[model samples]
Target: MFDYLGGNFPTIDRRSKKQMKDVEMVAQLLLFLEEGVRAYSQEYLDKAFSDRDISWDAKEEVEKEFCNTVKAIKEILDLSQDINLSKTRLKNQADFYSLFGAIAELNRENEKLTITRDIGVRINNFLKLVGDTELKNQSKDSLTDYQRNALEYYEAVKFSFTDAGTRKTRIRIMKSVIRGNIN
Candidate 1:
């Protein structure tokens, strides 16, 4: 649904029929990555909280999970362009809604993101909890199944995903999530 540049679709300079097909394949692969980004965000949040050795919402730690599938696709496709426009090859981004990538969007300027709707509400009753820091020193918080999966996937990626191909890693993680086999 999205690419890197403006957080929109990828633009392709008509290269070859083969290149076009490859781009199409990359597009399909990236489509599944939206959830991967979400899972990564969840893992990031959980790790940040756990490593703190205390319960506190650090707004600075909150960040929207985003993917640079465009670059990955470019690398995968081995795309390049000469200094002159004569050799141009790839272009993307007719439009993009950057906020769509955020787990929670407070407004046009708010940068607070959440792992999930339930966690966001638990952290704060407000629609926007990012950077609010009202979180108390609570003991073990209940995590959703998605959150658990995200955490498990994080550990899996840490070990098995090391030195793997980026595109393959993304697809593998997505498949694990779909199969509920992240453990």
Candidate 2:
């Protein structure tokens, strides 16, 4: 992760366990943002498609709602201050994890009104396109360029979440994998 930062830095000792845990917390925040984007985007798409004719007002409204929700999520995970100070909000790691679990449950309950299953199918199709022959045969440099363009298009036109909704779906799948829940 630090390699992605792109700067010369002095060598440091290996991270402590606490530092690793902090990194995990940051990872969770990233996951939440990713799912939040998907959920909000899907909400916008659903509104756009609900009527036979797409209304500019409806599209703007959806965009407004999505922006607001994303702002709220960012506030909840604010990293502007020292992370050690922020960790005081949750008494322990267990509490922190449980908070995400509760949030996932709440997100799941709220997703019944949306067409997540259909969206999931669309997302699957987009993934298949990304992995098709052209992508598979490309040189690494060309593949990187192609993937960036393709993914941008995919996100703009085809991104979606599984039946469980974005946030809850990721949580559920992670739990399932951890628990050996595969069929």
Tens digit per residue, CA lDDT, model 2, 58-90: 445444443443332233334323332222322
- Which residue runs of candidate 1 sit more than 4 Å off their true CA positions? 1-142, 163-170, 175-183
Quote each prediction's TM-score: 0.19, 0.22
**RMSD in Å for all candidates:** 20.5, 17.3
Model 1 Cα lDDT, one tens digit per residue, 79-125: 22222211111121111111122121222124432123332122122
In model 2, pairs of residues that clash are none
- The lDDT for every candidate, in the order shown, is 0.30, 0.36
In terms of lDDT, model 2 sits at 0.36
Relative to the true structure, candidate 2 reaches a TM of 0.22
